[model samples]
Target: MFNNLGNLADMMRNAGKIRETVEKATESLGQLQVEGTAGGGVVTAKANGRLELLAVRIDPKLLADGDAELLEDLVTAAVNQALTKAREAAAQSLSSLAGGFPIPGLSTLLGPGGGGGA
Candidate 1:
């Protein structure tokens, strides 16, 4: 029974370590930048690995043209693409840390596809 208790203690320690590693990884992920473009570069979107949209760029010509509908569509497309890239980067970063152990719920969080992209 003492041996079992020791094993449980070890498991708890390892779990704490894993949690710390994951926390650091998640924090760093927000610093990562990703860009996505649409309309053949007419519009570009930037985001962090946390999937937060940061900024957007529009070609001077597009704005000059004054096509509100087209501009809106392009902006939406760019933002969506940027978000996808951010999610992918965040997932990859997280998966690298979680891959070391067979932690319950971690697999599901990372997903079965294993690419770790949303």
Candidate 2:
């Protein structure tokens, strides 16, 4: 019982440090960038770890083809892939913040698919 109480006390003492680390990790997410591509690189999307779409690029050839539907499909695929990568990157950041402590509801806090969405 005394050991458990000591452990609790230790946790309390470290709570502030943990919160600060988490905050820094969250902030760093914005700096993390990832890219996804589709249609053999005809379409590429970039996103940050926060899951915000940064930019999308399309091959000039695709635009010249005038296939709106195909262009739309490729854009969608690339964006989704970019977001997926962002989620993974964010998860990695938060996981490192956790430092192996199994914080209950942490995954839920990250939002659907175990990574926070924009």
Candidate 3:
């Protein structure tokens, strides 16, 4: 009871600092980039830690092949892989901001196959 109250007070006192840190982390996320490739690197997708798809590159040979279905599949695979990496990176950034203090449902919220993604 008394200890809990003291802890709450401490948290309240640090709330502004926490908010600032989160803002900085979020801003940095846009600059953090990750890449994912498929079909032996024939298709590559890039995403930022904010989980936004940045760019995609397909090999010239793949385009010249004129296999639309295969190209679509490879593109999908590449995008999914990139988004997965972005999610992991974003989660890592937030986890570090938490300083090892467990946040309820954080892993599930940001982890691979959780929810948010491209």
Please identify which of the two predictions, 1 or 2, would achieve the higher TM-score against the true structure. 2
Candidate 3: list runs displaced more than 4 Å: 1-8, 102-118
How would you encode candidate 2's per-residue C-alpha lDDT over 59-110 as one tens digit per residue?
9999999999999999999999998888887886787667545445556545
Query: Which residue runs does candidate 2 get wrong by more than 4 Å?
Result: 1-9, 102-110, 115-118
Reference-based lDDT, residue 76, model 3: 98
lDDT agreement with native, every candidate: 0.77, 0.81, 0.81
lDDT of 3 by residue, 1-118 (tens): 4856775677679988877786787788899999999999999999998788999999999999999999999999999999888887887777777665444455564665432221
TM-score, predicted candidate 1 vs. hidden true structure: 0.76
lDDT of 3 at 1: 47
Question: Which is better, 2 or 3, measured by lDDT?
Answer: 2
Residue 3 lDDT (model 3)? 58
